[model samples]
Target: MVSRRVRDIEYAIRDIAVIADQVKKKGKKVYHLNIGDPLKYDFKTPKFISEALASASHSGKNFYADSLGVYELREEISKFLKHKDNLDITSDNIVVTMGVTEAIYFLLAAMIEKGEELLIPGPTYPLYINNTKFYDGVPIEYELNEQDDWEPNLDDLRNKITDKTQAILICSPNNPTGVLFNEKKVKKIIDLAGEYNLPVLSDEIYDQITYERNYVSPASLSKDVPVIGMNGFSKAHLMTGWRLGYIYYHDPENKLLDLKEGIAKLARARLSASSIAQYAAIEIFKTKSNHTVEMVRKLRERRDYSYKRLRQIEGINCVNASGAFYLFPKLDLSGLKKWKNDKEFAIDLLKKTGVCSVYGSGFGKYGEDHIRLTFLPELSILEEVYNHIEDFVR
Candidate 1:
């Protein structure tokens, strides 16, 4: 028998991979645009980082790490925030986990009681919604206006906050939509959270991947509000398989000590993240490399090409993503009487054309009629993928 929480959890990003695998068994090639992993395409993890991991492992650094994290790595993260974001965070306030996924799980477990709510963006990364459900917590979605570059509808956000709301979650250069939130909106969110005396869970996983300059962290802008900033080497450093991420607590007043303790307790329970990866990451943060700059340049080229081609399609409309590698395009299924929803359209497209994509509704309620696809593939491959999608639509 399955538990209700397990039954209700739907991670459409990976769920569609099963179908693609089955389709591959029939000798059809599947263009995997469904997931956001960059390494699956043209990207490669830096040689130095890999070497660091090998050196650590070879030297017998194979034992379990400190549950909080390696002191040297956490110290690097602290200096990273100081230099990059100008946020005065110390190593004691940071806890490393098995990626931001575990950081989120630990946060939910520590903070959410049954029926409490987490204010999150609609059309969000699915993990927030699924994890909240697993904790028996409510995910109150605030609208991001597609007509206005997917910025948070501040009025809608303000209206959604209630007494039961636990924390506000935001992902910049957001997944699925890939639109970066502007500075004015970021400040507004911090202001709102301050007014409510609530913590802001800021997911900055894609902070370094932006096309534009001057990306600000919510923690940097806040003076009194508690901002739990989450980031990792996965996206910025091309270390997705490393399973290393950390959350830094920013409470200038030193008010949220209990919450920090809760996270620490959970970290101790799990022992620690990958020790070899943590050792590698310490070197990653210490060294300055042009790898992300080159990665962004290539990704931008792919993004531009994919966005232009998707816009040319007759029945699709997409907001140009400024950061990250995803493009969430609204599909015009009205004329296509055969497909009832995005899921049906995606499945049929995959079966017919061997192009795999995650349907929009998998993200949240507001994501219906849309299909989220990544622009992480090479231009030549993307050209073929778009051609198949256009033909399928026609």
Candidate 2:
């Protein structure tokens, strides 16, 4: 029998991807705007990082290392966090996992019990939903206000709180929306967590993917409210395949010691994250690559281009994306003849024009009228895809 968990699980990001694959098998050229992988744009990983991994492997550093990641890499992570985010964190607080994906899983496993609830942002990355279900934890979604540049409706968050609420999750520079959380909003969330005695899990995978704003590290604002800082090299460093992610548990009150120990136990059970990847991760400190700046420049250009073209389409409304490479544009299908829902709109658009985009409803219930499109492809491809979408909508 399939497990109840399996029956309940759905990952809309990759789930929609299966249809894209089916389209490909029919010999149609699908312009993929589905996944957040930057390497798909023909962007090469930095040579120094690759060289470090090669050196580590050839020098027989392939064997399992420390369960909580190598002390060296952990130290570098601590310093990086301190320098970049100004967090009063150290190596002792860091735990390296396979990726931020695994870091989240480990953190969730440590915190949640069956039937408990996690307060998560709606139109979030789908992993939060699937993983919560995997452990039988209920997800209580708080909607982002579309009318307010996708900020969380704090009253909605206040209303959703229950005794079963275990933790609050925030994704700044949010997936799908690409809206960076303002300091006031984030500080307010932190304040709420403080009053409720709930820890906040901040997914900061796209911490570097911002423009015209400084990304706030949630942990930096609190010494009392425990903050679980989740980050990785996937989005920023173009190291998606490397699977290197780390978590820092910051609690001056020492409320999260048990949680940290639980994560360490899970880390030990998994044996260790890739030792070579850990080695490669440390070189990020040593190697300064101008490639990242250029990548961000290209990404900003693509974002502006996509936003401009998407707005020109008759029934589409997109808020200007301030960070990351995605645009969660609302599909105003009321005027359109062919579609009633975002899923049908996205799938039919793919089938008709070979442009692959994810139905925003997959992100959460709040996203039904929207579609998530990645701007990871170059400008020419984004322009072409937008052209096809404009034609399809007509």
Candidate 3:
């Protein structure tokens, strides 16, 4: 027995990608608007990042270092958190992982017991739900009301809590939606979790990519409650292929010592995440260059233009994405006589318009009529995509 539920789920977006591949084989320049990978969208690693990696590659520190990450890197991360999120994170609380994906997976594996539940937001990232199932933990999803600008429904959240709710995952500047959590909402969720004595696993990989409001770490709101703040350099530093990420546990009183030790053990068992990647990450962490800032500025510009363009389109309605590189637009397939669902719409669009976007149905239950488009493409391409989509929808 593999001790895993191998057949329970299939990442459907990747499945759709198979069809997309056929389109690519046909020599139709398919606009890849599906994945959130910033590097694929003309983003280059900042000069500081390259310089840091170059220095490390030349350095004789070719061997593996501490499992908790390099001492200097952890220290720099602590300083960065203190300055950026106003949290008093120390090096002791930080555990470097391959990426935020590994950090989340590790944490879920360590903390989740059989039959326990993780409260995930609907129309959210798929990994949270998948990981929950992989651990034999139930994923109890609460829908994020799109009509409410895609904020977490507090009533639904409060009602969803039970004795078995081990943790609640919050992805601010959330994927698909790009809705940044406000201080009030964060406080409420923290308070509710505190009441139930549950942990909050915060995925903040897109923190630095915000356009309108500032990204707030849940750990900053309360030192009293335990918060596992997961972040990595993949998105912000344009180092997705580097596979470097880390997690910070702000337990305040060493409440997570046992769990942290287990995570460290798991890290060791994996023989430590890519040593070269970690070395390169340490350098990226130390620099305050214009690379990430410039990327954020460009993404914001794209977000504004895309929102305007999509809104102008007669049948497409998109939420104003405040962060991240995606815009989830609800297509009015009601008028289209052929397609009945977003999947068919996506297939038809790829076949007709050569615009590839993953259907929103893959984003859990609530995203039936939607499609996720990464605005990471250049302005001209976006303009062209809008023109194509407009013509197709009309």
Q: Count the clashes in each prediction.
A: 0, 0, 0
Candidate 2 vs candidate 3: which has greater lDDT? 2
Off by over 4 Å in 1: none
User: How high is the lDDT of residue 173 in model 2?
Assistant: 90
TM-score of 1: 0.98
Deviation in Å, model 2, residue 233 alpha carbon: 1.0
- For 37-57, candidate 3 gives per-residue lDDT tens digits of 878877888777777677776
Cα error of candidate 1 at position 334, Å: 2.2
Give TM-scores for every candidate, taking all chains together and pairing residue i with residue i: 0.98, 0.98, 0.96
Candidate lDDT values, in order = 0.92, 0.89, 0.84
Screening candidate 1 with a backbone cut-off below 3 angstroms (N, C-alpha, C), the clashing residue pairs are none
- Model 3 clash tally, residue pairs: 0
In terms of lDDT, which candidate is stronger, 1 or 2? 1
Q: Candidate 2, residue 161: CA error in Å?
A: 0.8
lDDT of 1: 0.92
Question: Could you tell me the lDDT of residue 156 within candidate 2?
Answer: 98
lDDT of 1 by residue, 200-233 (tens): 9999999998886557888988999999988988
Predicted model with the maximum lDDT: 1
